[model samples]
Target chain A: MTQPIEKIETPKGERFIIPIGPQHPALKEPGHFEFTVDGETVKDATVRLGYVHRGIEKATESRNYIQNLYLLERICGICSHTHAMTYSLGVEKLAGVEAPPRAQAIRVIVAELERIHSHMLWLGVAAHEAGFDTLFMYSWRDRETVMDLLELLSGNRVNYSANVLGGVKFDITPEQAGDVLKGLDFLEGRNRHYLDVVSNDALLLGRIRGVGVMTQADAERLGAIGPTARASGVALDVRIDAPYIAYKDFQPALITETAGDLEARFKVRVREIEESIRLIRLLLEHLPEGELVARMPRRIPAGEAISRVEAPRGEAFYFIKSNGTDTPARVKVRTPTIFNMATVLSLAKGLQLADMPMILVGIDPCFSCNDRMVTVREAERAETWTWNELREHGIKVYQR
Target chain B: MSNLVDQITAGLKTWARVNSPWVIHFNSGSCNGCDIEILATLTPRYDLERFGVKLQGSPRHADVLVCTGPVTRQARERLIRIYEQMPEPKFVVAVGSCAVSGGVFEGCYNVMGGIDRVIPVHAFIPGCPPRPEAIIDGVVKLLSSLQSPAPVQPIMGPDGGKA
Candidate 1:
């Protein structure tokens, strides 16, 4: 399905070079891409990232397994649990310790909750980008209900620090369980309203439909994943494909869309949120009775294993190479944003400059958690402009 | 239709400016330590809005700029642009260990070390993305600082109107 990079000549002799992001209001992360355009069509695009690289991979080498859990959580605030979950699974495999059944269930619950929060957040951002301000406000306000539930379960709201090496650090009581159920019920109803807004809203559909079209073949060739790949009819989700944690016990329902556009991605995420709600209900009902933590090994064995978790974003893969120590010898993370960023540039081409914000925010690039920039030359001559200068320049040109 | 009405209007404006601070966040390139904490403040636990702080999407509509990460070479210009877009009388709050001193990324290439190199930082909230409570505390402290009136300009001597 890989399409060769083709070049098309246009009537206009001058080539169009559109540089998007690195500091765009539409993008939450910092990554830049330059698209070569001919007339209104995108001819080619080159992506440039590493703007928010903090050298976390190198920093991980210095921290122990316990410390690395916090470091991994810092990877992405929304998918903090998945990072810790995958890291713990990888290290546990090396240490030869299976988490207790109760702990496993708790992990599943937390992971699903994280997925719910992430998708709702994405929905709000996407809505905001498409100029649907009311949807943005409602979605973000609804997301707080899930955050409150998570806070009730674990002490912290964002970084729950629930996942440990052998088991979860916290447990839920009967009262807390009731609160969670009530929250979920409220979310379920609110989600239905969201579905109506996303599906039928004329403005949203107009902006997203038929925009940023990526073929199934293009997605596979680029290794696009999560909703991005699924939206392109690639039925690939790590939770179902490679079962990990309690996902093996309760498989997640994979949602796919054949039409690969912004609307398709939106549909996939919305459907997944519903699936997560159902999964959470089923998990809470089938709560197994057992101890939370098993005995964890003091030292890990000298071996390497790869663990992948379907984070809210996509397949969050963690490669842990242990050397029979409390700290790992090598730990590498392949976040989903790294792969999806490529598709953002591709989809951005041929689209009007005004539509760029919606397309950029659709991928939800977590540049801060992933890449670190490396300056090649200290004395390189590059033109720099301030925000005021750019705004003034833009105003002058647009006013005319 | 008098001086009383004008005084009341000015008082309301001052009160709104002090109570409701709209913050625009910019990530120059540090580890996401501070950004998470900033978001945490918005959650129900901290409920930063109850204190009248709100997160804004664009710099033009912002009253305060909460910046995280050590400014890297790639992000330096962008950071400056975002800062300049904001209106005057704006305050800058640098959050996290990285934003304060670049923390571990201080000596690394691409990193400019601290956010102050690019923008005028009004306050520093330290801690690898200081705790949520700490972020709230920092914002509150920044508000208190803004409450103080500007220092009177030094009177110039009659000789050439120079100090």
Candidate 2:
């Protein structure tokens, strides 16, 4: 499955193939990457994912709308809120209902707060990949502020199960709002210091500056989204382009950098942290007073609905189909990582093998988020296995 | 005198292993909820290293295998291989709800339920994704259990067989 492409063969008879994962130290999740390198320079790269594929889409069909809400939230722990929110917004659309204004505003607050946690998490991971443990430690140490804020709003630290069918599960009190603001103030200062270190610090700049330079044209050509494309000067943000929920009232200031290098990705994300801080503050100041959840019917009408929202990494998309039953007919999730994965392959060529981790982390690749399906292709035919067939096949293999 | 020296050496080795238990984390098929929290345990706030639990890169050098999520079929073989690679007397800590009992991912076609299906798990930290403190407590308890007079036997599977 991880065979190196033959077409990109080098002039030399012998090729140095480096297979990175499925279980590599650099990657926290399970993914397989085969890079064809010429001495230290990479000539071609191919990635094989599905190591962390849990069949969440198939699982969603069996579960009801409410159960699926929690199921989808587990798609990517970093962007768990985005997944739940996207699914809920689509389900609510299918049900012909909208969450109350207060619920919508609270959703935005949590989403932005999740974004802060995600970006900080990414910053730490990227720094760790760069061998800058100091920045990694400091950034993650401060990330707890946002994590605490999320916990304060909703109970859990990671899953946060904040979204339900038509609205959110909880409302932020005046005291919780005060706590969130205090945390954000502290985060804003730490993020500013991080921004300075990532941009101006001589040692850190050496590892990031001018490395993995993905031009704006290349980024757009390869369908790069989120901070990865924004760093390349592509002004594609789901919040700004199509306002959903409370985004229509509380808009986020676009943060983009023209460098399109690893440094730009760092800058754009760090700057966006400040931007998210401002958006959360504004939303808290004018949080609408209303019901948390609107009335949603148990059985949704037979129809199809699409939901799109800006996740921390990029735009998270969902397609939900209902059959007038309690359970959904089908649920298709297209996470942002899939869209941005192409950038890594394109950028892999002509770069040193050492810069691979930095380039890979630049897109914030989430294997679990993107590994939704495995298409088995055979010679002269392609086949789709039914649930029963798949189960039998699994049983047969395990029995062997 | 030789028997006494051997006992003292074994005691010293246990003390060292308990105090500085190196861990290697693997996401078998998890949502990464547990993986990140496990990471949080190491960072400054939680400071899991205070107990000398270092997150290692290679399984060969690790003392404990920190497994997250339900074991997916694709990752099961690799999980077994990783568990096998660690030096003998290794401890496996299954973190998160998915890892313990497959939790919400129980009926998923691709999921193989818990990590214990493929490997022996010494400690089970049950949470959707357990909090860092919970993870810390789980590891600490696993370490302290080594202080027992008898060696802990591997938990048997339902079929009364070792994985």
Candidate 3:
């Protein structure tokens, strides 16, 4: 059943309350928005999140630095390496250890590979939201090549646990190096096709051209980063601005667009896939030869540091505070989604309900990664229910 | 006529099992722990379709529900509603450490802890995200259980399946 768009007048003026999420189909995560509209135009928007809060920061305090790498990678699967890399850098700083040049180079390669995978995934999602199912299928199919490369490099597909305290856990052998080159070659070919589809597709252009426009000043003020910020003409990229991992060795191309529309966001991601391809090629050619790991002290001194890496999403921040123990005192991860989600309320105001999902997916907010769960009520009734209770009553009833 | 009817029923159930798996992804309020992993399965790497397991946009079309996150108070009612929307012979696969037993979100205020508190989970896929392969394995296991003639196991309330 569709509810008619209703408007209510306040002391200020007539304002329509448009609910965008919490249960909306547009968002992959669970977050709600109430937009005050005036005749198909958005006057103001209010965002309500914390729907999926899971208390990861609190969970991090109990775990040690080494264990935290695995936990941190869970921040966002699309940009898993950025979390691991940033966390490692923070801990390395506390330990006063520098990763070997070779390790740094490999980190850059994997990180770039992650960017390619993530951006490709976003392209597919954006395409799907735009009702371009073929593009979605094609882009996702090609994304497998990147994932295969990641699997080849680090044994696993998603959370590669490749990054360690002083350096990376895995090393690239001569055979692996050849495999990397071959993977890059295959991706170079597939990317051209992807670019062709994204750049020339008429239907996709019409859907995203002027949708969810964000001005440069507003994007900066709202703390937008990554493709969302770049789409608004922000030239800031952690890889180029700060230069972590092997990014310092080989500079990555910072792709930006001034349009600040959904189309521009699409262009930025597509261009980034190209730049990532370039960065990987450069790293492969100039890869330094040395040990992948560096010797380090067991206990990190009592010090605090913040490290930021340019994830495919945007600036992934990791703040680590140590207290002279293996277990960290505090570890706070401020993901790119947190900043990107802020722009959703603003963008949703002027858009139709149908356009909401496309715009939401455009930011690619990893709601699951950002939200933490909190208990609000106490359990008044307790029954030591067995599996049988579930099988007979709960299972059968819910099943039908 | 009876034999023909049996054949048609078998074919329809098989078609339904492969084509639709009605998924109810529960957040239970996690640190986005298993959420990304679940997303990963839908992405290119694991491409969940080879098994005919498609992520249902809503609970109504879902025959298999996948719940992530710990069971938080805010998500309880919404989770129950989504589960109730699916037709009969549904399977709930709880993914992640949080969904299984609240993982790290156990002591948090907003969370009711494990998902078993609110819904009947047919299978548990453990891990921060339970790796894509593990997710596929869990779904396959659930599918096989659904195909079997044994009675479905309950997750909560008295007279339910034993923990």
Q: Against the true structure, candidate 3 has what lDDT?
A: 0.72
- TM-score of every candidate relative to the true structure: 0.80, 0.90, 0.82
Q: What digit string (tens of lDDT, one per residue) describes model 2 on residues B42-143?
A: 999999999998876567788999888888778788788878889988998889888888889899998888887778778889998889999999999888
Model 1 segments more than 4 A misplaced? A1-13, A23-30, A366-400, B1-23, B30-63, B70-90, B96-121, B124-137, B149-163
Native interface contact recovery, model 1: 0.16
**Alpha-carbon RMSD to native, per candidate:** 8.3, 8.7, 8.4
| lDDT tens per residue, model 3, A282-332 | 888788988999998967899998888888888878888988987899887
DockQ of each: 0.18, 0.39, 0.24
Reference-based lDDT, each prediction: 0.74, 0.82, 0.72
lDDT of 1 by residue, A123-233 (tens): 875675565767766777788889788988997667788998899998877788888889989999999888887778886787788888999999998889888899999
lDDT tens readout by residue for model 2, A168-256: 89989999999999998899889889989998998778878998998899999999999999999999999999999999988898999
**Fraction of the reference Cα-Cα interface contacts (below 8 Å) that each candidate reproduces:** 0.16, 0.66, 0.25
Model 1 DockQ vs. reference:
0.18
Query: Where does candidate 2 chain B have its weakest 10-residue lDDT segment?
Result: B154-163
Candidate 3: stretches off by over 4 Å:
A1-15, A23-30, A367-400, B1-21, B30-54, B101-114, B127-134, B151-163
